[model samples]
Target: MLDLIASLLADKELDCRLDHPITEARAAFNRAIAEKKTGPIKRLLVEDAVLVTGTDSGVISGRDAQVEVWRADFAQAGRFVYVRTPRCVLPSEEEPIVTELGTWVGKPEKADGSEVRGDYTAKWREVEGKWKLEAEIFTTVKSRDALAL
Candidate 1:
């Protein structure tokens, strides 16, 4: 019972220390993507941040490059509101780094029902009292074609 108590306290402390900050940062990122704005995304990522998309050859390295990729994608004819909702954030009691496990989806901005959903894992590090995303890897598990069935 004492171990359970300690575990609960540790979880609470972790939540207080990192969970809220990471949640806000992630929400801002999602909103930026939905709004097709890269500034917020840029602010939330580290200088050497990396991203692996849900497609082949999607290894995007560097914060500037990732922002450029988003810029190009935003300029495309048809774009979706990309959102990543975190399901769990691993605790880092002594370290400044945390792991976030979540699901991602590209929902059609219209009523097209062209949604592509996937799972993703992101690494975030607290840099100067701010949680900045260091790396994120996404895997596509469901596609638009699959959604129509």
Candidate 2:
């Protein structure tokens, strides 16, 4: 299903070349976050969707539960917003599911907090002609100092 989003990248030409339906759906979810709208974001997930956060590997399981988390984040006065940019999207030949690998960034609304960058993987399923997020796993890359033993 084509996402209800206008475009993921600022350049429409680039999006046309790179974006698949899954990427568009993912982009729509990101757009909803920027727009601070939970309703649109809710429709993008399956009932049993799961999310594994970056850094701590915290899990947010289930669609309603995840939506609630997003609701809380949006409710915050100066919370950071996470934006995901899909680098690769591969559909499974045997199933109606696709895997999306991407990079994400969390930019603070206020200038005080530092920006967070990470990599993420998302599993998407085509449910009744609509693409929905099944699960997403995140990994925050440690700094060179932090990585050193």
Best candidate, TM-score-wise?
Answer: 1
Q: lDDT of model 2 at residue 53?
A: 88
Per-residue accuracy of model 2 over 62-115 as CA lDDT, tens digit each: 999999999999899868888898876767778998878777888776645467
Instruction: Provide the lDDT at 12 for model 1.
Output: 70
lDDT of 1 by residue, 1-149 (tens): 22353376576764523355788899999999888899998999999999988777378899999999889988887777888888767757789988787788887777476788888878999999999999998888788853566
Return the TM-score for each candidate structure: 0.83, 0.80
Candidate 1: which pairs clash?
Answer: none
Quote the lDDT for 16 in model 2.
Answer: 31
lDDT of 1: 0.82
Candidate 2, pairs of clashing residues: none
Measured by TM-score, how close is model 2 to the native structure?
0.80
TM-score of 1: 0.83
